[model samples]
Target: MPQTEHGANRRRGRDETEEERADRMWTDLIQEVRVAQTGVQILFGFLLTVVFTPKYAELSDTDQTIYIVTVVLGACATGALIGPVSLHRLVSGRRIKAQAVRWASRLTLLGLLLLLATTSAALLLILRVATHDGFVPYLVAGVVAWFLLCWFGLPLWTRHRHTVK
Candidate 1:
């Protein structure tokens, strides 16, 4: 859909009807979900194996608590990332591609947020355990701030800046 000066974009591309647009959006949403899903799955896998490591027994009570929190966060992230696929599978052939895309987009956003939290918690746990310095929290905070700026802040700013009134 090409935007003209009068805000008329024909509501679609030259070769695409509304249905086609919805279908394309659905495919794009699924592809994006796959990328996030892979990361969450990998992180969850690693977290699951952590408890069986010999170092797990040597962790202090606080480190152990952090580990538990991190693992739970990873689990939540995993669920959120994989949610869109299940949503699409259940809703297939229901003629709801537009609605499905909206729901999937929402799920993807939620998954990104969960991923942020999971990554932050994992970094905290790893840094604290690897180097019991007071700067671990600060370092993790810095990294989380960077992620926030890149993942959420900049996109929001661009959306607000470019949106027509």
Candidate 2:
């Protein structure tokens, strides 16, 4: 059985060689990336169109700056999320699938973090534009908190709580 090393005499995972595991991980990572990529791409596409709308000129300079920053963050997130696919394509048949998988995993993680930031920024900007209220920041903060708990906090907690020893 191909088992992952955990501590002494504590093997984990399936009976698969390193290459098989890498292939499986790569497939899993790509599927996960696809979901995130669609969202970021759609959001980025909408954001790009916003600049052309007549209402864009009506935005305060501060809001304009926020919009600009959000767009940039969205662009970066899109790039990171798509990076793993590019990396995989370029490294194909290099006899380095394990290294490729590791790098791809890192890229996917970085992409998720960037997606979190991009979403938060987009929410902040949209709320500010919609409400123009002093409490918009607080509202955005609350939503951000929810996102953090749902997206990151809960996952980490589950990993820590459920992973076998």
Candidate 3:
């Protein structure tokens, strides 16, 4: 690319400074996190209520253990998903928006990973209890594969294909 008068603008197609770029990225990141956080919180809320239900007491020992683990994963996912808001509250005026945004992005990614695990485990437990069929594991595996492909594979492939060197 030939050097334009606005050299940086020529490359990025935006005539924005570092702080401006950070602000824009932060806004976009927060919006994305908001959607993920809402879903995780709702799921976690449901997980909390499961143990209090009558059906919970009838669960097999293995299923109960799975329930316990799923709840823990849900809690972790909730915490990770909410971490960025707390991070913003504390670090808002620190003049390190770029660093804060990086940390927030990492937390969001971890939250998504935890959310995936929680969802898969919850699905496995539900299927085992509802069907008692030998194919429950296979069904859960297929769903998990779909989630992985939608959540990670496509985004990564697009990033690899489109990102400027």
Best by TM-score: 3
Residue 17 CA displacement from its true place in model 3, Å: 1.2
* lDDT for each candidate structure: 0.89, 0.88, 0.94
Clashing pairs in 2: none
Candidate 2's error at 8, in angstroms? Answer: 21
**What is the model-wide C-alpha lDDT for candidate 1?**
0.89
As for candidate 3, its clashing pairs are none
Each candidate's TM vs. the true structure? 0.87, 0.90, 0.92
lDDT tens digits, residues 32-130, model 1?
888889998999899999999999999999989988998998898888888888988999999887898898889899989999999999999999888
Better of 1 and 3 by TM-score: 3
Q: In model 3, where is the ten-residue run with the lowest total lDDT? A: 4-13
In model 2, what is the error at residue 15, expressed in angstroms? Answer: 0.9
Residue 97 error for model 1, in Å?
Answer: 1.6
**Stretches > 4 Å off in candidate 2:** 1-12
Per-prediction CA RMSD (Å): 3.4, 4.5, 3.2
User: What is candidate 2's lDDT per residue for 24-66, written digit by digit as tens?
Assistant: 9999989999999999999999999999999999999998998
Segments in model 3 whose C-alpha atoms lie over 4 Å from true places = 2-10
Model 2: lDDT equals 0.88
Q: Which residue runs of candidate 1 sit more than 4 Å off their true CA positions?
A: 1-17
